[model samples]
Target: MILWFLGLMVVGLYLSFIMMRRSLKRSALIIVFGIGVVGSLLLITLNDNAHFGMVKRTTTNEQTIYTASPNVQMPMLLKQPAGTADKHAVYIYKTDPKKKAVHTKADLAVRNEISRTADTTASLTSQTTRWEYQNGFYGALFNHEGAGQFVSQRNQLAIPKDWFILTTTQAKRLSAKLKVLQHPTAQQKAALATKVKAKAAELVKAEPELATDQTTLMKQAQKAVQQQLIQQAVQDVQQHK
Candidate 1:
């Protein structure tokens, strides 16, 4: 995209220079060239500013499963479980900021209700901080002084300053879905693997140029399917909830 923009600018400048040379009046040529240069420079500046602004926004919007203050220690449970140690281990999706703005009223009401309920539960005395969702995974961000003690006893897990503990039912559902995601049925895996291999073989046979990268292409396809399955699992949990 950047290359295309630069190419256009170069072509525009060349045309402008040609027009300046052919002009009858020197003052008119100077005025036109100056305006064109100024306009182009302004556009380039705005384009750069916009690009950087987007990069800044994207950086700030990056999501993580866990984050901790300097004084806090991260919990072990938040770590990826042994088997599901790939990109699909923890699905993280960013919500559209515009959609978030649109639903602010209803979301606020729900949040207030949860806050009130948490206030009443003595066991949940810890201050109820805001909840955040990345993809379908939900967790509350709270502050607790005795977070370490909670983790040691296994009474309640602490995730940095906030903890994400699932109810028995939620845990069961999450586990079941994750199992399907991490380890698809033998038949499912076999079918997809065979299809990918066959497609790659055909492509390589037709265009021998792609033969060298056949293995890489096949792995990418398999990885894509795995990611799709993981997303589906997340969606299932969200819908059921």
Candidate 2:
């Protein structure tokens, strides 16, 4: 609709210019051409302003709330209350620090347990450790973080049950590890792959349901890991350059 209006304005201006060049009566040409030019300009300005004005109005009304740490932006899922569009009416609160602390401790313990078990059989490489973390409690915690963000942003207290098992600290730690893997040495990469395979085997043994679809699961896991690694590598290069 806006595009059509703009196109019409352009065509009107072009026609007005052509008419001024061809018309024999100078006064008549000036008056007609002047009206066309002024009308087109007014229509274009009004239409553009109306479109942009709506966007600005909507954005102002739907305020995006963030936690104390700017890194974690909460999802907007709540609807505005009946008969109210006031920004001040929106509820905002900090995430519970004590709950987050407890969850982080539990998540660390789980990671340690996995590392100890993997070590008893063979030396765990960075890659293997990453795979294990993704396939285990770390993966579960990621889901919680997502859910927590949604719940918190909506000003709701009832978070996902899984949120009680992981915290923001664990999520940050996993993110740091991923960044380190972005620029691994060749030997480290090889070691990581070997460890990953070993961890996958361990997972199959521990989870019988995964045994039936192990090949498919491993392929999916590998694809997800590689995509993240590639993204991290690109970010690292761009940042340094």
Write down the TM-score of every candidate. 0.28, 0.23
By TM-score, who's the top model here?
1
lDDT by residue for model 1 (115-191), tens:
11122111211222222222221111111111222110011112232233332344457567766655668998788
Quote model 1's TM-score: 0.28
**lDDT (0-100) at residue 16 of candidate 2?**
58
| Model 2 poorest 10 in a row by lDDT | 52-61
Taking every candidate in turn, the Cα RMSD to the unseen true structure, in Å, is 27.5, 23.8
Q: Estimate the overall C-alpha local distance difference test score of candidate 1.
A: 0.38
Q: Relative to the true structure, how large is the alpha-carbon lDDT of every model?
A: 0.38, 0.38
Model 1 stretches astray by more than 4 angstroms: 1-172, 181-184, 194-211
